[model samples]
Target: MSYADVNGLSMYYREHGDAPVTEDNPALVLLHGGLSGSDDFAALVPELSAHRRVITADLQGHSHTADVDRPIRVETIGDDVAALIKHLELGKADVMGYSFGGGAALRCAIQHPDAVRKLIVVSFPFRQDGFFEDVRAQQRQMSPESAAFMKQTPAWELYERTAPRPEDFPQLVGKMGEWLQQPFDYSEEIRGLQVPTQLIFADADMYSMQHICDFWALLGGGQRDAGWDGAARPGAHQLAVLPDTTHYAISSSPALAGTAERFLR
Candidate 1:
């Protein structure tokens, strides 16, 4: 566990691989999902670290990081990351964020473009107008047994929801409960992002596939007159649908990492 004071907040992070002090071999910042902390990328880090220096951190109020007095917003989290990069003297690095962290990565790219070189967002909800209402409704429709199971089951069990043991159930429930309260909104901010971006989604993800498609289209359509090559190029902005994979595709499927590595390169 390493600590860095960023914007008056003590940020905790795990660094993997050798960070080359050259501009050519930049580091990769790995942002985990909302409920899950840097632990979410535990399995993928070894693979990603092999290619680039990897830095994973627990967001404010999650994992070992302390919570702030005010309500947490995605922009605030982005600012924290920006401060961390500046504090470390890391000029520009690639960012890969999953789920809720995906939104935060996008916010960082928009807010501090000079710090983020490339962006990769997996299973992110960019536009939250009608999307969040559906999420709220889905939460309301969850049965007591299902809700209880989610709250009590371990994250590993949640990742592999088959033959879960009694001990694993509580952690899952607690994680789900925490996710229900996390704050994230980027509908207004996403349109301002000018960095090269890639969006990845699982076929069996609970989020809207159409929305993801629309987002890719919007970003590809020249959101800012910057003329994003990924959007304009045929293969730019690769939209991969991992077959038989869930929202946690990065952990569930090893093939997803290969695809992501290629996209990042």
Candidate 2:
């Protein structure tokens, strides 16, 4: 239970487990999905923290963090995350995010490379068009009016239990709808990334398999074969698609932690 006054937001964050920070074992940061809070990662953090400290935070306008006048955009959230990392005096940390948080993590690595040592993006795409058309259509339909329907969901329950102002849920929903409507593509930036990255997805993710492979290619993956000694492989970037999981469940999958630990180590 801690809050950092970073980037004009009283960002809520917490640390779990402990280990000396080093290039090979930097602190790890976890970011939850859209309309979700740090608590969503409560089950996964311990597994990830076994070898190093794990930091989890609620992004602006979600969960314990109150909504500000600013709109909820991935770029803005990315800046907030970078600010928090500095606020904690973490020099640099390994960042891992799921879904909406994953998008922010990627932007953080792209916009504030110095603040991140390694990156993990789970169940997110580098381009707006990477999402299936029907999924995009569904996102477009999100609005304040849909709040009642969402009330039946676990996300809504979490909001009711933890949000600073429960009534603002609809407003948050509206802002997310507006943000999702905006189009963006960061393929060039990703291709030029200097930070080590690992992209993880579910077998039945919201994104098409082709789009996922394209995103990996941007990370210098899936391009060539590794020789017998693995000398011809691309950069340190890696990709993993968890079996028998959907985007909704990938973050909680036990395999997710194991896969990420292997890369983080």
Candidate 3:
């Protein structure tokens, strides 16, 4: 376990295994889902770190990383991840994030393209409205008061176990609620991205399938067919919808790790 002083926060991060990070074999940085910490990737890290160094971090307001005065916005978290990369002096690493982390990873690639080699975004929508109405409603209903209910959930358990200030859980919930309620659409930004990227999602995610397809289209995918000789392929991007998985469980799915490994290779 380690902490990097970046972006005005003591960001918690840890490394698994060891490997020479080269142009052909870059390091992998992982961002976990909302309300989850670095340990959220326990199922995927071992396999992923087997051949390369895997870096996992607890984002702002989550786990051991104490929150600062800043709001919990994806853009800011993305910048923090980029700063951490620079702080560690790892040049051009591959970044993969899940759900909330996916948004941050995408933002990182957009805001700091030079720091990333390739990107993998899992189980997160590109637009705020991409989520189903029910999910959106739930997000809007969240508040600091909801902390009482969260105490019965696994997220709260983890928070209680690892957060530097466990009493701030309510404040964290409030910040997330505010951020989730805000409207956002990154269609133009995603279309303009130059980084090689991959999109992963569960067969039944919280977001609509139509929205997911639109996201792929924005990445220059699903519009045409590649030639039999593999000469007419689309952009260097890939998409995977894992079977028998849901948004909450996609990050832990073995298929998720396998697909990501193939894409990274």
lDDT by residue for model 1 (1-265), tens = 6889887677888789985745777788888786457777777888888867888887765665655554456677888888888887778988888877887788889899999888888887765542546666665544324544455445434334321133433343344444455555565556566777888778777577677767776665424443555444633455677778888565536866787788777
TM-score of each: 0.77, 0.98, 0.99
Model 3, residue 265: displacement in angstroms?
Answer: 0.4
TM-score, prediction 1: 0.77
Count clashes in each candidate, considering only residues at least 3 apart in sequence or on different chains. Answer: 10, 0, 0
What TM-score would you give candidate 2 relative to the actual structure? 0.98
Give the TM-score comparing model 3 with the true structure, all chains together. Answer: 0.99
Tens-place lDDT digits, model 2, residues 1-265: 8999988899999989878777667889999999999986777888888889889999999999999999899999999999998888888999999999999999999999999999999999988999999999899999999887898899899999999899999999999999999989998999899999999999999999999999999987888888899887777988999999999988889899999999988
lDDT of 2: 0.92
What lDDT would each prediction earn against the true structure?
A: 0.69, 0.92, 0.93
RMSD from true fold, candidate 3: 0.7
Task: Identify the candidate with maximal lDDT.
Answer: 3
| Global CA lDDT computed for model 1 | 0.69
Q: Across residues 1-265, which tens digit of lDDT does each residue of candidate 3 receive?
A: 9999997899999988888877788889999999889877998899999999889999999998999998999999999999999998889999999999999999999999999999999988999889999999899888999988988899999999999899999999999999998889999999999999999999999999999999999988888887788665557889899999899988899898899999999
